[model samples]
Target: MPSSVPKTLTDWWCDASTEYAFLGFSYEVTACQSRDQLHREFADIRQNFNSRYVRLYGFCDRKGFYDDIVDAAWANTLGVHALIWFGFDGDDLWKGRRDVLLGALHSNPRAKFVTRVLQFGSEPLYDNVLPHDQLTQQVIKAKANLSDLHIPVTVSELAYGFQERGGAQDLLDAIDSINIHMLPFFAQDASTSAQAWPLVQRDLQWFIDHGNGKKMYFDENGWPSVTSSSVQPNSPNAVADVPNEQGYFNLLDQHCTDLKNVVAGGVGWFAHIYSDNQEPGYGIYDSKGRLKITLAPRTSC
Candidate 1:
């Protein structure tokens, strides 16, 4: 018989929902054609897709990038699920960046208003950026610093991290919700879009069973429509082999159907991405900001 992994979930997670369905879009100006082009894409997200929220990976960009994000969100009436990364270059440089981010949030009314939830770190354990104990402490201190805002605070980690041993138990105990990255498409034995719901359901159930009854937020979720033949299967860059664009749409339709229940059951989920990228090809929209065939169903949701 196989032995059970130790439960890393703390007792503080309670039954509740944060009531926010965010769209995951990493903001990198260089990735886009131009700054104006990026702003137009955000506007398209709001007006076309009915996206109420977005999650940025981090705030360590060039001068005006923060403003660009806030302005775009505000103009479109979208909430911001802001993520912060501490892997800054040079000694003690992260503190300065952190201060700048907080300052913008404190001083800029639009920035503060659009900021719905503040995530302190992303995949820290998986990335090996910090020890679990220290990570927990950072989450505790960050929660204290942002207590006055009354928004939810969380540390985002991969689903497997929370399900297995040496996960973010202390951090989970400290925060307001469980933010998990549930991406079965990235699994080595990846499922076809048609076979995704069962896998996703099991994954979500694993988190919920161990979630200490806290709000389970699917922080990132999506399917890729493109695959490079040369890219090794089950590797970091693997994309499923759907027959055509219509097959991708069917997969998304079924995936969203599965997710509707999760959201209805007091959980939250963010679609994988807003725009397709050079690599991964997971975007619901092409690089030119045109809706991919898979995105038609999302517009009504």
Candidate 2:
């Protein structure tokens, strides 16, 4: 299905399994109160998957900061690998909380540090700030902030997290130099939806043909929750669950297999574990985390 010819990297992807399982807490900020049991909970989540890779880094404060966020590392294996890119404000957040971000980055700048890096897949809340050269400059400067550092970036290639609407060419041109984890999260309606697979295929072909298809990833798709559709829309945010599970994963698996044939690296799962019945319901699992629900796409609900 994917037009990609077999290359060594693609070959590796075909054979390897980058399927990661996520383990998230209630998805909230934790002060880790004395005998608070957050650590105990974290341990349980980590051990639940046995595998070292983490697809879900909890549901709250997707960004890596704050005292509780720092404690998240304890949940991660010292050498375990994972990704964390819930719309990070690299330019602004890095400025004030460089230490926090750097600490997060240091864990796995290289593949071993963190299998991949993530960019902002957060909603296009700030469409105005992305179109200008300023966005590129900020990203560049942010990368510069870690010149000697081994931290590599994982980009939500489809995500346009700026305050303005714009084209991918500029963003690609901007990130071309940075040797981060070159992966796209399938967010851009263009990137994720099966209907847009044709365009994505074309884009991938262009990149591979032009030799500019740097490190790539299809990190998202299949979130059942509508944009901002949480468990309890009125309450604080919680990792949401997808409504039509099978239907959602059908597209997800198809995208994974198709891209696996094209990209140099194996595909990374969008998430592993997330909260449910809280705020947004984009999770692969149900609220109890016990049921593996699958919903097949239908012509009509």
Candidate 3:
């Protein structure tokens, strides 16, 4: 077994592998970043980060970029979970982009080997980028094309969206899982790190019960370390005094532990990110590809 894998869900290893099958990293590549750098980073993740999958954020626009990612994942034996953008900028190029992305996924020789799940969109309702009906149709259309591959297809939403009965319900029935962004600290009724688990668990149960038997998967979950100005401005959803380094460790450790016991159930769980960025703060590694305080002593097999 790879040394980067964790031994148990609660092990919190500095140098241990886990029995868990699908711990993933949310990845975002900036324009300035090079393909060579990505190749090295992908290798590093496979060797040191204890992750078997990656959650890519958009319906990739550049063929070269998409191909580079495929090469990287293939070289490191990492699964790729591609997130189809849901008219984020507008509907102008959405259809065309979807066609291009689907074509690539269908034809890429390496895709069938490394691609695990193809999500329709990420947090569409939270951003109000696309109507629920439209997103549902997009998922259905993709499901039709990719059904032969037999990968799970779903749309991501915030936990709160599942609490009510309406468009969110329509979506829950149309897709495979109750995939959501469950950031308790970012919830409207936020709590501190030590007291956050119950609140998070309550939301998870709400999704499991109300989501009409669909499996639950956290599309994004992590506590931010910097509440002040650095990288991306702290999200508006974040509570005041979000968490320092130690607080981040405490919250993530507890949440992930509970996730293994109360949720997942052999399904996947993706951390919000692999590394800190100039825009987003929820990264285990710093911009220099170094482990941050929260991920000190990370080791390879």
Candidate 4:
């Protein structure tokens, strides 16, 4: 058993050692999802995959949606990486979403314990949801507003968005650390995860070169299991199927150490999704919540 206990949210994040990579799944909590479903899913995540973290993607529109999520996560002994989602419109939408998240956080005392990180927006820069400077200001303000909770606040964006977008450095300097989304499936490279490993490494190197030495986390990374006509792969060489999805995790298990060594603070990532019920093709489980691919046993070296 561990002797040290984490008092603050940042402490919880820091508790994971640089020598080992922590595993997690990105789950979207929809208003229509039942409480029983949430409990069952989180239980399956903990009991089956032995994952300790969950990166949540959703807004607080319906009452008790977030509370149920936190409760279920706490019951399963999983840490929550909560996201405050932003739409394509502007600050009004952003603020409304922010306020809703703040309300949820303030109302639930357990939120401080269960939530390890509070991500401000997902892909705000890539989608041009807000001006870079304005987004930076909001992040700074959020960090200040939630300082009492002691949770690390950051924004999620594509890995290259930080380098391509103007004023990214200012935003980077404002946040606690960098949260990047890297999906090799979208690249014009080889098909299978084995073929995509080189591109993954190249993306990691890009971060190492330009990330300003901040602690980096891949908030989203996984291969899609299937694709529709509208969701075709960028490369004809690429394929979307269950075998490739399994190969991605297999590669992660085999090269987990190299992934950790990409930065000084060590890197952590969450599998793109938990179930296809949330998003088509990206899930380890199918839409019916049945396991489609057997996850490789997590290995350190």
Candidate 5:
């Protein structure tokens, strides 16, 4: 037997490389913010995955903002970094909510806040109702706005329930990093995992072509999803769930390959079934917050 073993790409990436595999747990601060709670949670999460960092999202929501909320949530926590954000500001909320969020993050040196689309122009839910030119202009302007705050915004959930894999070069060039929230299924798609493979390959090419020299993250893209029944087939409400087993594994395998080739800053999972009812039992961890073994760390080969 060889004296030393060659670590699998995943192992080396997570354990040895400075590029950490952050299997982050995301939640609104108000939901999981108490310092005692955050500390307890961090230790458990660390045990489950040996994760180097965590994303602490949603500090402010309809309930509104509070001073040092992020600080309060993360109080006394060590080894994990938080990505907090002020929640959605609908047409009715405070006028300068985004500005307040920015200032809060600035004061809390330990917190990193990522920005989302203040509004999406062509999203299907809006029937492409949001003005096209104005929204696109805002996206471009948003980049400069972030620079002014000295806050580098990592795009998250940008493709919200859509799948147009091309044009990533321009997209990546426009911001600090590109994040595509790609789900594994769409009721309209016939090939399931196979249908998404092309997009994955194209994204990999984007990373290979540019990411090695720049910051790029597929902030959300994965095979795990709600049950097949969740799909609302053959309607304007169509959706295809990422099924478990063979189909999902097929995509999971490809995703693993992409993780190997691409210079990913991190990958965030979509559910915390225990805390939020996004999709029950779809969590990387069980209802009590214990990690699934497949995702859990291994001590033996």
Candidate 6:
């Protein structure tokens, strides 16, 4: 683990080694969730997974929720990759979300120490919630406003979304680093978990080829353990089962070193979620908080 705090995106990218690539999980903070629950989850992330960071998703509708999140993460010595989510809502909603995040950071001194990055929105362009230019402008404005915080500002999007927006250079140049969501399960060629790494590698290479020299991180990546009834698979071979879920982790464990070398500026990824409670069948832990599969520590590999 790194002993020092990284104040800039370049510092984080240059300092990370293959052995200790920033490992973490993506978490959702629901409204009205208690601080005790937040603390417990963050503690599990820090102590059990030995994670150094967490990518937080979802909105902060409840008052002082961001404060609670930052406090909980800091207490467990974990850095926060804060996300200002923009759903199907209008511009006003997302702007409000951004303001709430900024307010929390300004009010809490500890947030400075705990916040590693601020992602303006997750997949807003892909989801059609905001057009490319509008999202780009928002990111640029947020980046300017957060200049004093010294925290890198970015927008999380699918790899293809950036590609579709003609490389999104204007947006890319405005931000510090690239945060992408690359899930093999959703790909047209999706197959068994044993075969998912190749898809992951291919998508990762696509990003590296067009990444504009920016350090890239996988904001969401993992294989689901079971198929949710409400969801449909993109490929006939994209079956989800317990064995395949375990196989995916096994493959990930085997390729940790390879991932570090293949991607420029090293590689860091948050498993899609912390538990099945966040997204059905995507968690290493079940909804009941029980271990669903054997997750070998990244360092062990």
Q: Write the per-residue lDDT of candidate 4 for residues 1-301, one digit (tens) a residue.
A: 1233345454444454452454678887654478898899889888877787889875556767878887888788888888888855665665776887777777787787777778976788887787788888988888887888877789988866766685487888887777778789888775788777788888777767766777777778788888876567788888888889888877877877777776664777778888898878988888886899887556244
TM-score for each predicted model, relative to the true structure: 0.77, 0.54, 0.79, 0.90, 0.57, 0.90
Task: Write one digit per residue (lDDT tens) for candidate 2, span 10-33.
Answer: 232212233322112223222222
User: How much lDDT does candidate 3 score?
Assistant: 0.62
Off by over 4 Å in 2: 1-100, 103-126, 157-168, 176-211, 225-243, 254-256, 277-279, 285-301
Q: Give the per-residue lDDT of model 6 (tens digit) for 162-219.
A: 7777777677777777787867787889888898888888877877786666677777
Weakest 10 consecutive residues of candidate 1 by summed lDDT? 1-10
Clashing pairs in 4: none
Query: Residue 242 error for model 4, in Å?
Result: 1.1
- Report the number of backbone clashes for model 1: 1
lDDT of 1: 0.60
After aligning candidate 1 to the native by TM-score, how far in Å is the CA of 2 from where it should be? 58
Could you give the candidate ranking by lDDT, starting with the highest?
4, 6, 3, 1, 5, 2
TM-score-better candidate, 5 vs 6: 6
lDDT of 6 at 7: 49
**Each candidate: RMSD:** 9.7, 10.2, 6.8, 2.9, 9.0, 3.2
Candidate 3 Cα RMSD after full superposition onto the native fold (Å): 6.8
Q: Per-residue CA lDDT of candidate 5, range 83-148, in tens?
A: 323234334232254455546554544333222212221121122322334333444665465554
Give the Cα lDDT of each candidate.
Answer: 0.60, 0.37, 0.62, 0.77, 0.39, 0.77
